[model samples]
Target: MDRSEYLVHLGNLEFFHVKTGCCDADLPAQYFCITMFQIIVEGGRNMLKTIHSTVLSADVEDTGLNLAFCFTPECGDYEHEECVNQPNQEETSLDENLLMEEHWRKEESMHI
Candidate 1:
């Protein structure tokens, strides 16, 4: 999979689009949803969780799905607020600048 060079945003929050492989076979991919995601930022210093599942395939088999999900301050509860006013939580306060810089750095490291 190729590295994403963009960050998705919902309102004032920032998110990363993670990809998932399609069903190998024998099942409809739509029957499943991405409930939890493990995102590594700054080379594994931070672990982020996924917020929502955006299905790209319609019950199709062997099709790729791109889910645009956000990483919030809180995890395991879907009802939690997307972002808080805390100025010290670097994981939840992923601004566009930082995300872009990270993306560029990854690209440079990969020589893409």
Candidate 2:
């Protein structure tokens, strides 16, 4: 319903990862790759929002497996507009600076 409520619902949800085998020739015979993932759901709702997943270390000889999981929020229509506008703003600022430099160079040439 609200921001805090949504967060609380997500916080209560259980998170776990499922490992899947990855086929790679470079990996040793004893060493195999495992993929870990967890499903994130909206609080109190049965809807599936996003899937968080990552790759685990494939080195069997290594004592510890370092896992790094990256979570990317699904972009909605409204959020997509903001993402597009940011790049346009940067490009506009760069174009203005280039124009100012060009004008300054022309003035210097005239004085010379």
Candidate 3:
């Protein structure tokens, strides 16, 4: 993929560096490098599975990238930090969380 298109896809993935209302120019080159690694490296599926597990195990309140909140357009800003910190009305239910995980698994399979 070209740079702009790559960024758009990475942006959709809701990484902290790309989703924090930061402009594309503001992102560090390392983020792009990591993404490229994920896309191009053989056996990257294991790496991504580990990352996904780590994110799920992490304290969502402390970390900025709460998977439950990550996919929404409304989450593309610092305001998402507040949602992560506070008990928001839009918090995902247990079933919803399961659904989201299943959806992500499907998406990951498609990409692979």
Using Cα atoms with residue i matched to residue i, what is each candidate's TM-score against the true structure? 0.23, 0.25, 0.24
| Residue pairs in clash, model 1 | none
**Candidate 2: tens digits of C-alpha lDDT, residues 1-112:** 0000001112343333232232343443221122222335557654433344233334544444322222223322222445335553422232343455568778989999
Rank all candidate structures by their lDDT, best first, as comma-separated numbers: 1, 2, 3
- Those runs of model 1 whose alpha carbons end farther than 4 Å from true positions after fitting are 1-7, 16-18, 26-57, 61-112
**Could you tell me the lDDT of residue 47 within candidate 1?**
61
**lDDT per residue (tens digit) for residues 68-98 in model 1:** 3333324333223444324675431223333
Clashing pairs in 3: none
Model 1, residue 89: displacement in angstroms?
17
Q: Report the Cα lDDT for residue 19, model 2.
A: 27
Which structure is stronger by lDDT: 1 or 2? 1
Show model 3 residue runs off by greater than 4 Å. 1-88
Best candidate according to TM-score: 2
Q: After superposition, how far is residue 27 of candidate 2 from its true place, in Å?
A: 2.8
